[model samples]
Target: MSILGVDYGAKKIGIAKADPTGGPAVPLTTLIVANQKEGIERLQQLIASEGVELLVVGVPVSLSQSGAELLRDKDHLNKQMQEVLQFVERLKNTVTIPVELEDERLSTKLANGMQKELVKINGDDAVAAMVILQSYLDRKKL
Candidate 1:
């Protein structure tokens, strides 16, 4: 199905576009997901504009790491990012299309590390959307 991938965040929501053929997801513009109402309007506009049949949102899940360095998750960070998921959850009821959530632990980091022409987009909403969309694509592969 044609879909819009969203990197849900408090300040901004990253977005990506993909068709049902299972191809590379292209980065679209980012949305300023301000609050509950604003988030809904933006998402609705995006869905209509892109003719999206499905929506994929990123969920930030932090881990305790259990005495290991790898377990040290940015709890505060994810807590703040929780607003994104809240928006997505709320949208689940209002929208006609299906919504999917994927783990977005390292998408921001990946966005920050982009190089070359993408260097300008590093740490921006577009890169974040790429991470979200790519994760969705990878998951569907398995």
Candidate 2:
């Protein structure tokens, strides 16, 4: 089944796609939406057009110093994390396909590093989505 990776943000949402047979994910595009409604609507269209079967959204989670334990204190969640959770909730409520969350601790940083090496990078958001999706694909192999 084809999979779509999403690096969602308030204004810009990064997108990436993986083949049905499981392969490396590639940068797709960045959706610049004014609001969540617009973003979801565009994502629905993309999902239909791309024939995506699964949707994986990158979620930011706080980890302890040891990086073994997850920090789930709602009160301690940063604004961005809270917003992402809200976005994920709305996405889950709207989408027909199964939605899964993948840890995206340093996806953007990795993407930025990649951007410096590549001459033709498809925006930071798209690259970040690629990073998120690629990480998911790699983990599935192990």
Task: In model 2, state the lDDT of residue 70.
Answer: 33
User: How much is the lDDT of residue 1 in candidate 2?
Assistant: 52
Q: Return the lDDT, model 1, position 95.
A: 92
Per-residue lDDT of candidate 2, residues 1-142 (tens digit): 5788999998999999999585689899999999999999999999999998988888787444432343356456789877887787798899999887778879998888885644156888888888888887887761
lDDT of 1 by residue, 15-91 (tens): 78888677777778877755777877888988888789988777666322231221233244455554665576688
- lDDT against the true structure, per candidate, is 0.71, 0.82
Query: Which regions of candidate 2 fall more than 4 Å away from where they truly are?
Result: 62-75, 115-119
Which candidate's lDDT is highest? 2
C-alpha lDDT of residue 101 in model 1 = 68
Tally clashing residue pairs in candidate 2.
0
For every model in order, what is the number of clashing pairs?
1, 0
TM-score of each: 0.78, 0.86
**In model 2, where is the ten-residue run with the lowest total lDDT?**
62-71
